[model samples]
Target chain A: MASNLRSPLARVRGLGSAKDGTGHWWAQRLTALALIPLTLWFVAGVLGHVGADYAEVRAWIGHPVTAGLFLLLIGATFYHAALGVQVVIEDYVHNEWAKLASLLTVKAALLILGLAAALAVLSILFD
Target chain B: MSAQDEAASDPKARRPLSPHLQVYRPQLTSALSIFHRITGIALAVGTLLLVWWLVAAAAGPEAYAAASGFIGSWLGLFLLLGWSAALFYHLANGIRHLVWDAGYGFELPTVYASGWAVVIVTGALTLLAWIVGLVAW
Candidate 1:
C-alpha cells in the first residue's frame, strides 16, 4: 500500500525546491560581503563631514570620486538590507498574506531609498 | 504498558508541535536574529538622516548651516552614536556570515563564541570611532 504512490521525497529531491534556496541564501551573503568595504568607506566619509558647513560638505561630495563611491555605497547598502529584512519578515511574519506584503513593501522602499540617494549624490556632483 | 501509558510514553506519536520560535530558549542564534532585525530597522531610519543631510546640502548655505548645527547638537550626537553602533554590528555580522560561507565555524561552541565576539568587537569599534571623532574635533 505504501508503494502505491510516488514518494514525495523522490519528487522533491531532484527538482528545484532544494537547490533554489541556495540562490537566495548565496545572494544575501554575497551582498553582505560587498557591503563590508563599502560600509567602511561610508563611515569614514561621514566622519569627514563632521563640523563641515554646507559648502564644505558640498565640495567634498561634489568630487567625482566621492560621488561615485557614495552612490555605490548607497546602492549596495540598500540591496543588502532588502535581502536581509525579507528573510526576517518571511521567517517571523507567519501569515502568508502579511509576509507577502512585507516582502513587497521592503523591496519597494529599498528601491525608492536607493534611487533617492543616487539622485542626491548626482545633485551634489553637478552643483 | 497500558494503552494510556503507551500513548504518553511514545514521544514520536504526539501531534506536530508548535513552531520553534514560540518554544525555544534565547540562545545565541536567536539573539543574533534579534540583533539582525534591530540593525535592519536602525539602518532604515538612518537612511532618512542621510536624505536630510543631502537635501540640506543641496538647498543652500543657510539651510545647510541650520541642518549642520542641528546635527551637531547633543541629540544629534546621541543619534549618531546609535547609527554608528548599527553600522558596526551589521558589518561584523556580515563578516561572520562570510566566515560561515567558507565552511568554517559550524561547531556549536564556535558559533556561540563567535556570535558574542561579534557583539563585543562591534561595540568596541563603535566606541573607539566616537572617541576618535571627538578627539579629532
Candidate 2:
C-alpha cells in the first residue's frame, strides 16, 4: 500500500502534506475539551472575586488547588491558542513568506506570554 | 505559488470547490461555522486580558490596582463583555463539534437544530455571566 500517493513532481518540490497525520486535529480537540471545565471554573472564580480586594483575590489564586488549575489552564490555553491562530493564519494568509513570518511571530509571542503567566502563578503560590 | 503548482492550477483561482461563496447561499449552518472560527480566534486574543491580570496580581498591590483599574474601566468592561460572549459561543459550538466528531448529528434537521441551540446557549450563558459578575457582588 503506497501511503504516500503524492506526485513525484510534488515530492521533488516537497510542498505537500504536513505529514503528522491527525496530531493537530487531535490536540485541538483535546485542548478544547480540557478548556470546557477549566474555562467555566475560571469564569466562576473571577465572578466570585469581583469587587474583592487585592489580598482576597491574591489569596484565592495562591491556594494550592487554584494554583494547580491556573497552571493547567495556562498551559492548555496557550497551546490551544497557538495551534488555532496558526490555522487561521494559514487559511487567510495566501502569501507563503508572510504566512511563515506571522505564524512564527504568533507562536513565539504566545510561548513567552504563557511562560510568564505560569511563572506568575508559581510566584504567587510560593510567595 | 510555485511555478509548477501554479501551472497545473492557478492557486488564486483554484477550481472545483463546489460550495464556494460565488454559488453558495449563506445559511444558518455556514453562518454558525463562521462564528465558531470568529469566536475561537477572539478568545485566543482575549487570553491577553487574562495574562495581564494574572501578571499584575503577582506583581503587587499597586500593580493589581493598575490591572483592576483598567479592567474596571468602561472600555475594559466592554471588551470583557465581548470576550465572555465569544467564549460562550466558542464553548457551545465546540461541544457541538465534539458531538459531530462522535459520529452523530449529521442529519440536516439535527445540524440546524444544534446550530440554533449553540446560539441560544451562548446568549444565555453570556448574560448569566455578566449579571453574576457585575451585580452579584
Candidate 3:
C-alpha cells in the first residue's frame, strides 16, 4: 500500500458510470411497453388471416390504419432488438475486436433490414 | 501483482469483467433471466423473416407466393411455431421484468409465481393463437 491517504471517492473522482446504460435500459423497457399492445394487435391480425390468399392479406395490411401501426411495430421492434442484441454481444463475446465487429454487423443488419421492411410497407401503402 | 492486479490498480481500465454466467449455479430466477435474453435474440433474428415477408408483399403477387409458399411449408410452420412461442414467452417475461424494474415484485415467492404465470400465459396464448389461425382459415 502507498503512503498516500486519498479518499476512495476522491481517488476515483473523475471516473464514473458510462452514463449510456441507463438510456439503453430505459429505452428497452419503453419499447417493450409499446410492443405489448402492438404485438397483440399484429398477432391477432395475422391469426385472423392464417390461410388467406395474397389479395386478402394485402387488403388487410393495405389499410391505412394497419400500415401505420405496422410501421410503428417495425420501428420499435428493430430498435429494441438492436439494443438487446448489443447487450448480448457485450456480455458473451470476450474478444474486444470480435465483439465490436459482431456488434456493428448486427446493428447494420437490423437497421438496413428494418428500413427495407419499412419501405416495403410504404410501397404496399402506395401501390 | 500480475496483469489483472495491474488492471485493478489502474483507474483508466475501460472494463474489467469476469465470467459471471458460468460461475453461478442455475436457479429458477437466473434461468428465467437467461431465457428472456435467448428468446429476445431469437425474436431479433425472426425480424429477418418479417422483412422478407414484407419485401415479398412489396414485390407483388408472384414474389409474394414464393414467400408465402416457403412460410406455408412444414419447416416454415415449425419455425413460425417456435417464433410465436418465443414471442409470447418474451412478452410475458418482459412484462414481469418491467414490473421488477418499477421496483415491485422483489419477493422470492412473487418472483417464482410470476415466472410460472408467464410460462402458463405463453402456453395458453400460443395455443389460442394457433387455434384461431387454423379455424379462421
Q: Each prediction's DockQ?
A: 0.57, 0.70, 0.74
By TM-score rank, best first, the candidates go: 2, 3, 1
Query: Higher-TM-score candidate among 1 and 3?
Result: 3
| lDDT by residue (tens digit), candidate 3, B1-137 | 89988985675886835436557678878788889999999999898789999999889999999999999899998999999999999999999999999999999899999999998999999999888887875
TM-score of chain A of each: 0.81, 0.87, 0.85
lDDT for model 2, please: 0.89
lDDT tens readout by residue for model 1, B8-30: 55757855555465777787787
Off by over 4 Å in 1: A1-15, A18-21, B1-23
Candidate 2 per-residue lDDT over residues A74-99, each given as its tens digit: 99999999988988998889788999
Give residue B88's lDDT in candidate 1 (0 to 100). 91
The superposed Cα distance between candidate 2 and the true structure at residue B137, in angstroms, equals 3.5
Q: Give the better candidate number (1 or 3) by DockQ.
A: 3
lDDT winner: 2
What lDDT tens digits, residue by residue, belong to model 1 across residues A44-103? 877776666666888998999999888877877787778777777866686678888888
Ranking by DockQ: 3, 2, 1
Reference contacts reproduced by model 3: 0.88
lDDT of 2 at A112: 92
